[model samples]
Target: MSREPMRRTIRGGRPYFFADPAIDKILNMVVVLGSEVWTLRERLAAFEAIQVRQGGLAAGEIDAFDFSPEQEAKLAAERKEFIDSLFRILQEQVEEARGRTARAPQKPAEPVAARKRAVPVRGKSSKTAKRRSRR
Candidate 1:
């Protein structure tokens, strides 16, 4: 099978399956990351099996291994970076929302004659419209 190049970042909105788009995005990220983790786990298992076959490794050896302080520090940094990447989408969403709100209040003020008050519809409520818009 052919493989596609990995993307460092993805921008803009993604297609959503649920009424709550954030749920969809979170689910998608989980599935994608899960598959990647599974793949790495499989490869690691295979490598360990081969090492055992060659008499170079033993069961529990990896779990018992100790890391140096420098190595531990490096691993901690890498782990932090990996977690940040996993939730980068959420951060982007927050930033985008902030940008929208920040720009909203900056719109040019309209003259009094051009301003119109919203009228309530007989059967429809503004709250319902807002709820639908959030979906």
Candidate 2:
């Protein structure tokens, strides 16, 4: 059997690549956040595993189990730093994204008189509209 290649569809118009400084900064922040999150998760998992192993030792099933308080303290400190760094990165990303969005070009504003003339008033027939409809 053969399978078709998968394709992704963007919700809006064509995808836009960001090479702007603000965008680059946001991307770097995301990378930092991702790495910190991964490290924190792994460290927490290891701590949990250690706790489980220590619990088993209390039941006398294991001869001995040793856990260092200093190591746990160090991991806790590292976790705190990672969490703080993650928050900082997240804040920076939010600010950069906002800045990028704010800097985007807005639609040109039409003059007041031009705007008024652009719309067809009620009970009024436009010659341009009639000409186009005939074609």
Candidate 3:
């Protein structure tokens, strides 16, 4: 499968989507965190649904719904590793980019937006419409 090319800095040719590397990093972190939060929310919802069927919790037990201690620890470790690995990848890319830039001045690549063009949407019911028109 084909992959899209990485956008680079206008000055040092560092690979980054946004003009500022920090902005790109923050955007990626936000997306990753947002997805993690969504997954946790879904898990909580399912747990609560089960609780409701089994009978609502006792008073002052609002925080009582959830995973076992082991599961919680495992999840926390996974989340931490995910975040660490994300930053590590960004760091590696920047380092590699810096090395390349130091070797020689790099030429600017094509503008990110200009590389893509909007495609026209097609009707899903085209066959049915054609049949009706023929009749």
Candidate 4:
């Protein structure tokens, strides 16, 4: 008796089969890692949504929230570390997606209106008005 190989159909298209065990292992690992990363990001987004609903940083004075000075400092440090770690992971994912060995850091685009200097409106000269008053 003969047995056929297992196949995978992606997006309801044709079925594809992988013959190499190593390739299959790598592919499965990537899928799992990607899903885990996505889940973490979703959870972080939900936390941010809750923060927004609670009025965020603009709610009131820092003291208005419920932490002591030491506890607030510790929380700030932990938050900073978490942000840094997340940024590192995001950079790695971006590099991987772009198929680049090194991540190309992008500069933020400046707003066109913000780049322009504000022009003052024309008005009667103060010196001319003073001379007219003297006359």
Candidate 5:
């Protein structure tokens, strides 16, 4: 029997459950890169088609076209930079939507105005009567 690759059954895993935000960040980056790679593949197909049509190159040759050292290095460097940037963004997990946002300590709530004003205790007593709030 053939086994199916592991599949995420529920919207992929939840990133919030982990104590470390890095996991979430990296996971998100992976998803983004996956989409980008698909986009690149589609573009590559079109690019190769154009090259074959106009340059009269065989599909296989165009597919394996050689790049000059400078071009090759540039592309390699660009890919490295993209991956680095993606990870760097992960490192800065504070900006991630699912990451815990540092909220400024909420200002102590102002004392709510009570509808009833405290009246001086009658005969040294401590009970006060409720009064309607003043507009």
Candidate 6:
């Protein structure tokens, strides 16, 4: 029998654990990535142990390993997908904010007369005073 991984389906938005929801989401993503990294590390260690038991690998063999063009392209795609997933929450928030702004009714622009401007005073030594003196 094959087993399928159980997934948690979040309805609406996820509950905020911190004051800022973004912080909470970022922390969640970090923990998830950390768990995934730990799992991969454990698997690699186990695989290396088995390889040693069979036939010992050369020092720095894993580090020196190079991927083919095809493999590199595949890894690149996967990396892009991983990055998109990591920042998806922030992207969604930005999109939502944009949508709200688009739907909002904008205030009408004030007329030229209604807008605030500096009124030239006929004070001594002022531009108005100079014009008057010239006249």
Query: Which candidate tops lDDT?
Result: 1
> Tens digit of lDDT per residue, candidate 1, span 1-135?
799988878588556788889998788899999999999999999998889889889976888999999999999999999999989978865764465456667776655555333223412544445557999
Q: Estimate each model's TM-score.
A: 0.46, 0.30, 0.31, 0.31, 0.36, 0.45
After superposition, the stretches of candidate 2 with alpha carbons farther than 4 Å from their true spots are 1-17, 56-135
Q: Rate the local accuracy (lDDT) of all candidates.
A: 0.76, 0.66, 0.69, 0.64, 0.64, 0.73
Candidate 6: tens digits of C-alpha lDDT, residues 31-126: 999999999999998888788677787655778899999999999999999999989878855764465456654956545665334223324324
* 129: Cα error in model 4, Å: 91
Model 6 Cα displacement at 50 (Å)? 0.8
lDDT of 5 by residue, 1-135 (tens): 899899756786654745888887788899999999999999989988887899866769955879999999999999999998879856543343222223324445334453123223332321112112222
Error of 1 at 70 (Å): 0.8
Each model's backbone clash number:
0, 0, 0, 0, 0, 0
Error of 2 at 135 (Å): 69
Winning candidate number (TM-score): 1
lDDT, residue 61, candidate 4: 45
Models, CA RMSD each: 13.8, 20.0, 20.4, 24.4, 18.5, 19.8
Tens-place lDDT per residue, model 4, 25-129, is: 788899999999999999977776677678774434434668889999999999999998878867654544353223334745446674343223212434335
Which lDDT tens digits does candidate 2 get at residues 1-135?
A: 799887786667653368666786688789999999999999977766786677832433233644489988998999999998869857754664454356654746556897568455522433335446899
Single out the weakest 10-residue window by summed lDDT for candidate 6. 116-125
Error of 5 at 54 (Å): 4.6
